[model samples]
Target: MLQDHLLEEHAGPAAETEPALVLANAQVVTAADSFRGAVTLQAGKIAEVTDGGAIPSGAIDCQGELLLPGLVDLHTDHCERHAVPRPGVQWDPLEAAIAHDAQVAAAGITTVFDSLVVGLRDADQTRRDLLGQIMAAVEKGETLGLFRSQHFLHLRCEVTDPTLLDQVEPHMDHPLLRLVSIMEHTVGQRQFPDAEKYREILIKLFHVPPEQVDERFRRDAEASRTFAPTYRAAICRMAHARGIPVAAHDDETLEHVEEAAHLGMALSEFPTTLVAAEAARECGMATIMGAPNVVKGGSQTGNVSAVALVKAGLLDILASDYVPVSMLSATLRLTGDDIGLTLPQAVKMASLAPAKAAGLDDRGEIAVGKRADLLRVRLVEGHPVVRTVYAAGDRVA
Candidate 1:
């Protein structure tokens, strides 16, 4: 059974009150259309959306900027970068939380699932223990209302690590633990179909000597072969019991998608090939692609490009992955491309679709009775700039 102590510790206290804020004279993007409008907020929830014109009492003028539903990031390692700024350097968890929160808010993400890897083959014991502390700080920040965005935990389970299941079960009941993605980073497959490129990237990431890369890869490959099935079963059971959404990452084949579907996983994140993505779609899973992949014009791992997937009607969500700013920028870029998507459709990939996939139904669209998470952006010379950000009707940036 999942531990309940972690949940109790993280639940801190109840919120006292909800503040109201209104935004007017902006072009609001709804599920249906984008038009000049005003959105009214009451107790941190959108009360109404009206035609653009005279300002209502207590409404702040948006000055015709484009108002969008705040971006929902389903996968981001930005916080992990803060926790480990360098190979061996570590920052205070609270300090890292503050820095990452501010950056994410400034980038117009009002909701983020901070992705942390659960299993590491060569990481020191101290580094593994830091995950608990980092998660605790995130919960504390949310409880104190000190964060700019709603922070949730998404454990990236390394299914090739035998110890992963043990570490993961203890945190399954964490209040902020909302999502999990089963990932196997074994070389020569899935995301890294090219062994040579995989070797190059792994060497840089692990700061390993070039000469030792091949030996380390061989060892890791053998370990993955041994642990894959055991880790997969454990993760599926734990996630299902806790009622958390599970995702399969870097899927490369039809069988991969079929297996995830059998586990009742609702998301297929970064399917490496078009065949995998299409198979995921057939299995009724939402396909997520990296926004950076779309912006950079190709996949960093040499997989099918996000734009190509989008054009083929297989991609449903766009995650910032490593770069938070790329989320909005890529959406805008997609609007101008020949992907048969309008501004609203493109925006949905970055905002609405992710929220839906994460089971957050309250704040993805500009609709009444939803959390007033919003972003005010302006397009200047074909570049998008975020002018303001709000989470739960409170201005955060």
Candidate 2:
């Protein structure tokens, strides 16, 4: 089983021949509780987790640092952040992906869903131009073992775009395409529920001329109304057939949640309103929120609060979103400062919850028979910092 699940290999270090690693004498956080324990890793699996058990003489002593399951980030646009540093500056695809990998691993994300843009809007041809090259680079990087963390692709499909299917046609059989999300960023809907705020965001981030903002919004709204429904249905059906989880993005209204439920969406990514999130949960769809939103105390685009959703018993998974470091920070914060949840609960939200959301059951928990993907975190000055990362028992960061 360990051999079957070992990571893909090429030129870099492989877990197959790596010797067993034992992280002993740490405060281990498991799914059910936390204890001063030792974890044994061998054959790419967690061999044991024992409280005050006999430690191997060769074990690496953790010295009471917090040892937790490696975080699983369901959505991180940090790849795109590295690919495009400034608004218009494009970096080398391979270099950006490598840098993103290091940042992600160092941030303690052992498994990450790289949110790559898949849109057909002519308004952003540059984004489309980089799509193929970037994705290829990511695949090559992974196969070559260039990334410390396990990487997967999360295609953020722009349902309102005219050539949405065309943009994804060739990659239909891509192995890394584990997730697909239906999203519409049309100015007046969902994510941009308020037209004025949407216009301001466009003028600021997108550099849209104020005089042309209304025209662009109107055009996008028209495109959304005409194409979104059909594209959503078709793309969702294809994703379901391929065994890839589909998520509805920026859900705002009850109707949006109902539509996503009808289409069999397994998750709702970044619902913009509390009502939408509640509706999604009621329909049995897992709700995913950006960890950055929790750390920042609000959304950049003025959406419903993630922390509020967590308090309401609606949030199911947490994604790194735009900040790789936000995952660990948010988890610690959510577990700290009288946030109503214990450390184990918050860690589950960052790890097992997201792993299950992505249909990965082999990892995400510090338990016997699970992949030995783990992290050693220490708190200093009221902040959580990742000191070490292990992927399948191999120390990668």
Candidate 3:
């Protein structure tokens, strides 16, 4: 009945109110296949997809460009770059959100799970308070129809930080808070297994003095040891109660994956070893890896490579992580050069896989009943460029 109603509504005089966006002569990457066809979008959902080229009155000729489902980035810290344009320099939350949205949209991401860090030992009170402000701005922008993509919050909780639970308490009720990633950034494991590499990254990114880096790590380690267990338990309970999808970040061992799975986390984000990824698969948890890892040939943090995981059949979904443009690039890279995957399979990592992992079923594919979140892209010199972006049938970029 719903499908019938949608067809009738889309085909009837209501079409006069809603302009039909007919994409013609395009290679459409649908779930089943990639075919040269015409797609008609009306009222923010796909109205029809047909092989016979029946050009509508106001059709836009794609001229054989590749059209794929809009990328759904499951994890990214790109918003932090906008919030803190430069170290110690802050922009208005709304402005930062808008800028981040524009960058993501231009990169062909129609849905973004903005990873906002919720814990820092030495962070100022104002910095901790900024999370609510940022979430509010995202909500306002979405409601106002000012953003190009649908934005959701993925609160990255530093399990080692004593104050993380407190910081997130008030905002757990927010509807946009769909995913919670428990991260333990202790100096000895996960991301910074090598302390020297950790110090080097700190100096490069945060500009911390060599002496201060060691001192900071020592202080943070003590705090982490003291507070990690309790903080992790509280956040897990809260997230579970709220029906939020919980993920464990950089899990390194089978024990680590087991503990997270027992705690009700259904996703493993960037597990550092094959043991952990395999354990996640066995536990029926979705494993998310970074797209940059696939494109750049390895993990920047010296963890297990995503390509290796994929080779072992352990990789489930790919997130953009820190690079918005890398989603499409990594998808193409995964398809291999000589005998690449079909477009449908290649697009899945950046679209349906991430969406299914995040429990977002309204979009991430081209279908009659799904949201009209789509992207028109063209490969230029082996790189994917966003020609146009649409979220719920509205052109944003």
Model 2 TM-score, 2 decimals: 0.94
**Quick one: ranking by TM-score, best first?**
2, 1, 3
Clashing pairs in 2: none
TM-scores vs. true structure, each candidate: 0.93, 0.94, 0.92
Give the per-residue lDDT of model 1 (tens digit) for 153-264: 9999998777888888898888888899999988878988788898888788777789988888888788788998778877988989978999999999999899899988
lDDT of 3 by residue, 103-194 (tens): 99999998898899998767898887787888888877866667878787899998777777778898888767889999998788877889
Error of 3 at 247 (Å): 0.5
Error of 3 at 185 (Å): 0.6
C-alpha RMSD of each candidate structure in angstroms = 3.2, 2.6, 3.9
lDDT of 2 at 343: 86
lDDT of 2 by residue, 144-238 (tens): 77889888889999987888899887776777888998899987679887899988887898788899987888789898889999999999889
Clashing pairs in 3: none
Query: Candidate 2: which stretches are off by over 4 Å?
Result: 1-18, 53-56, 124-126
What lDDT is reached at residue 16 by model 3?
36
